[model samples]
Target: MNAPAGISTLDRVKIFSEITIKTFDILVIGGGIMGAGIALDAASRGLRVLLVEKQDFAAGTSSRSTKLIHGGLRYLKNFELGLVRTVARERKVLNRNAPHLVMPEPMLIPILKNASYGYWATKAGLTLYDLLGNVETPERHRMLDKTQTLAQEPLLNPEKLQGAGCFVEYRTDDGRLTMEVLKTAHTFGATCLNYCELRHFTYNEEKRITGAALQDKLTGKNYQIKATCVINATGPWSAKIMQQDQPEKLPELVHTKGVHLVVPFEKFPLKQAVYFDIPGGRMLFAIPRQGVTYFGTTDTPFTGNLEKPRVEKEDVAYLLAEVNKMFTGLDLKPGDVISSWAGVRVLLYEAGKKPSEISRKDEIFISASGLITVAGGKLTGYRKLAEQVVNKALEKYFPENRQPSGTAKIKLSGGDFENAAAVKGFLKSCQEIGQLHKYPSESLAYLVRNYGTNTKAVLKEACRLKAENLDPETRLLQAEICYTIQNEGVTSLSDFLIRRTGKLYFERGQIIAILPAVKAAFQKILTLGNGILANQESEFMEQFEAAVAFKNESKNAMVSA
Candidate 1:
């Protein structure tokens, strides 16, 4: 029952050689949140699992989410009671298991004179929401008067503000959560590889999938892996994988593009997260995090590159117009936007339904070739989706020794606290470490929150490199870079900046200042060549440009005019 040597990040070449010769009980494709969840569920149940991602983990839709682990209160408007209850209950499970990664945030829903729901109706809806989800907050839902609402969020448009409803929602770093899940799975003997692409599926004589042909993107070397079962948890790329099994079949999933914009808190400062009204019966969220106020998510159907979805000028203009209308005098422009992200939702294709109108419920599809595919679920419902997918795989392939999912009772990696209170105490202890090292309190707190119990390891690395005489900030950055490369399988610079650390999105302003230190850390620790370091730097820059592509597009358009 010994777990396979921890994650294989430090020596990937050795692990790659080993996995090619060893067979697994399950081979999971696409190491996003869903694949990570499936690997955790299966491995914890004593099943041998191998998970592969074409890019770095959480480099897709999983990283580019609105980043809320809520019960989907908005689903109540559509009367999707069951969906609300499932995700709400899962919300509590996530909070219980990963308190640092899934901290609670107070959400304010402003009631406008021309609002979709009146104050009373909003109250009743939340009442049902609480009853269904078993919401347990210090103070559940409260109805605030117009004066109280404005006092809480003075930036709201007060001309026609009726009131507001304050409730609890859990905020998360989606990419970090995915990494923690995969790491926990690795602890249970799951072999995971990022930057490993699946070329095609291998089949037995019965035409059932036996395994897959995979290629390491970094080494450009190919390997074949054998497994009894193969699950397509590829999220947006589910359709593409399914086509390999049945080329004549139509795509069962549709890609819906969601875009988010980040700006300095000084530009659009708010005390708490606000889910407010926009035109056309829709709404949006503006949440504050790490000195930035970020908001988004236009629900338009996407028909572009799946690997690289870009935020468009129209998408930014739409969000800006809506948010500006709701918050008086903000007058935020493209220049105010420091960074932005775009992700595609791989949803179940329902005829004649708009992207916004489609249900977020996940469905399992088993093709004639025994390829099991899961499509269309929310970020909060990932564990449940994984449980469902695992159960079906067990029921079909390994019926003799089926095991129930124990993920709910287990903590994710870096979330080994006794309880929520203990997590807070741990954060306090992390700040003491910062004080000892003369590190900024804010930076230390950020590390503790994102890395959870693993912050000690980061600090240990920082201590080891103290003789380098680097600035405290740069030293800390190098320590994080080292930690992620050795442990989190950070194969490239963008992976560290975007997913592992979240500096690219939340702390965009500091990226340029820290780039040199980041490159130095990677080079010193991994002995990367100058050419490799340059390529990684160029890739990171491309990611940064993608975040501001919309603004650049407008500038290009103006020049053409």
Candidate 2:
């Protein structure tokens, strides 16, 4: 089957008309995975859904994750039974539904002597994790002896080897999967627009929310998007929206930052994904991703501003230090990192308690003003949380006849697919035909991971501007970058180079050096309103530079901050 094409400008105009001209049934604030999940769930249920984001889709924590779709084997120690079951079920759903994006991953937990969780404890956790999703998920966890463990992962630090345990989970491209949800929502006739900020709310005499007034962060245009119900699925920003609706009862969010670093895959030891202990027992991932070894994610409580959280210089050092401890010595350094990022997880805040100790459970607050605020949950359990939030909202509207959300059975974009190898062959054939002038073989593999079946569309976009016009390093023909601006809704170069193409995480310097080329592409593809190029380019470059530097910051600052 052929892949999908980009949204047409006429279609964009229609979406604009619906969002700005017509009042929607439900307005979802946030276009990350959870918000996109909510939009897909609600739209499938026959609701007129409108999803809005302050930044590009998956621009926040959703895109900047360890990119694992698992049953939360780590949470098994915390004894979060419900979360485990829900996430396990959701993981199964993701694997079954979005097969194109979510692929099975083998995780080797290298059990060391006298570790935080020993061999038996790790085995028990894996058993529970597998049981949560039932037999259909994957093979049950198995124990490996010292010699066998070394055989499975010769790269593992063997001095203190007490054997290793293997379990089944999943790996995915988080940003693309989130965008697939957005595309799925759009396919079901939902309205989604990025750079649309929720400035404030509208209230009736009874103080029930009528909707919200949004400002397009790009055009500085104001819009009053009226809706019967408004949902705050903004993850960490959920508390802020809740406060806006009920200013007196200020609720708190247990926001904790998680950071990940990118390095060449050869630097990280082991084959399958390795889930091991970190300093402070806070947890971190050193997963192989996108042909690069990306290690991450220390969970520490934060009390800083909710905007862009920087990955500190020390946090990077700390992550390198921890991996160094486990692997003995990979000789990784700050310079080895191509990119890093910090995202505030929306954990449930309990007064006088640390964020790490706080519950991973989600919360849904139905305000007296009819605003539905959802916050604090792991990504794996987003669909279940959405059902809970949507059900609460539906109760007010339909009362006794309210049915729960049935997104569990629904498929997202390119869901239930099995043609990755065939698609790769197709792409290879196209390149052989001189269809692509700029894309390199090395980068094409990564692009396949990022673009999925829609890769043809991107290639077609490049081909549209004459195949002979590309420079070395593929500088991605001028047409391809423009497709991102017009079709993928990239509001800035950072959104394009960082999340859209996803090069920033692996090769930002090479990408940035060709900014003038990208700018030229922007000029060619984006037929914007008059005189916005200079202003837009300056703004985009500023965002692009900041995004680049933000990743260069250390992991300890990311964790400690």
Candidate 3:
């Protein structure tokens, strides 16, 4: 889709110019889901907002989540009814507003004879879960007998199985969701610049924050952005940014690491999503998306570098062991892992509690310098968190100009369809367009689902590339690349593969197969010199090799053991 007028384009020079000249009403530091949601919320309420990210949007913990817009069912086990209700309600709102990105997914929690929670207890929990979330009757929780549970997912282990609790959750494309929110905010006149780092804050006589000094990572150029209120929504890095204001205060964040492993569908073949408790009393999810099944998330306290969190050998081993035990006659080895990702969850520090015991609730802190900092929130609760943060900033800075948030009702970019039926109609229309372009039906459906109303724009770009003498598949990928670069502010090949398309997790082999064609298209469209292209290629290769090596090393270690 063509960028709305006055919205900054992907060009760094133009964005820098706008940031230098304009004094925004709200400056958001960080472009993850929190910052993106805050920008959208504030901008939709008529605030002149500017969002700056040190890296690509969702390049951090936002993209590394379990990819579920789920109510915290496990939190119920902790007696945190309030968190569950809030997340469940927010999940409904997200599914309603961004149907294209968040889709209903049925999940099964298998009950075993030796399970921590007995059958009746499990049923009661799910019943309360459904009621609290106001789940529709058709999608409400149901108790399935052992035979029925196995039928729903035949691969599940039958040994010592009692039954299963089935309920509906929503799955999402985390990175795409963040981008769409920012895009919608842009449509409402929010200026967002990725690859821009907030170096320092500008202060007034009374030490009130007036603006920020930013440095563009790509161009190495500095720019100043003045705003009436500056918000620090930097997720795991929130403490570091807060320290810039007051070095004497102790850090309030305790970061925990979560890791996920992806395996091909043919290898795992999970028919439905499964939430199972392991021997350690921690829960894990095995969810199917596209042609692969991904299971995650080992939560352990982490003190390592946050930016480059890799799946450690122990993390992969624990997941593989649990998955193998949960499945029937299937012994999953380390080699089964195609790709892995690790992310840090910035949680509020609670003394005398384990990492998993720390609350996921967000906290807002205001420094004496008038810098508003928000930290430690879940992805599902991002919109509500943003609303609260924006409201606080407005109340503190613009008390006379406070506006009610309209973000809960406003559709995200590419999410303007009237309903799910409308989305289906859009997909059907795209299939018809695909017929005219000789595009595959399945590929066209993928595009429509991923791009929503913007499928037409992507198809237009594909049609324009038909004369390039590329293969059908390459043409489709080239079209997406072009659309991403032109529209999504994708500056690097990694951003396109990892975040924009999710090929890194779901289609790792396909990415390797199409790398050459993708690189060629990138060079042609970006007009990058060979030196710059080489550097980008080197970086991509390093990441690709690291992922491959992680898997290979695990397999080798297992074999040696």
Model 1 C-alpha lDDT versus the unseen true structure: 0.88
Off by over 4 Å in 1: 1-8, 137-139
Candidate 2 Cα errors over 4 Å, as ranges = 1-14, 135-138, 399-406, 416-444, 471-479, 528-561
C-alpha RMSD (angstroms) for model 1: 1.7
On TM-score, the candidate that comes out on top is 1
Per-residue lDDT of candidate 2, residues 1-561 (tens digit): 234534333254456656767878899999888898889888877888889998888988888778888787777767889888888878777766676677778878888887888888888877777788783634678899989887877767888778988878888877878877787777777888887899999988887889889887865878787899899888888878788888787566677888788877766645667778764556766787656788788777666765678777667778888888777568777777766667778876687766566778887778788888887777787778877777776777646545567677766654534444654575576466443365676555555555555655666665655555566444444655655555566755667776766667766557657777776666655654436767766765564555436444444456788
Worst lDDT 10-window in candidate 2: 1-10
State the TM-score for model 1: 0.97
**TM-score of every model?**
0.97, 0.89, 0.97
Candidate 3 has what TM-score?
Answer: 0.97
The lDDT-based order of candidates, best leading, equals: 1, 3, 2
Better of 1 and 2 by lDDT: 1
lDDT tens digits by residue: candidate 1, 387-485: 999999999999986678999988888888877899879888888878888899988888878888888788988998899998888888888888888
lDDT of 3 by residue, 1-561 (tens): 234222233576876886778889999999999999999999888899999999888989999899999999998878888888888988878877878889899999999886779899999999899878888898899999999998999998888688899999999989988988888888888888888898999999998999989998998988888999999999988989998877787457888999898888899889999998877558999998888899998889988887788788888888889999889866877777788888899998899888877778888998888889998889999999999999999899888876799888988778778788988988888888788777899898788667778777778788888898877778888988888887788878888888888888778888768888888978888887889888988887777766656767766876999
Q: Whole-model lDDT, candidate 2?
A: 0.73
Among these predicted structures, which one has the highest lDDT? 1
Give lDDT: candidate 1, residue 31. Answer: 90
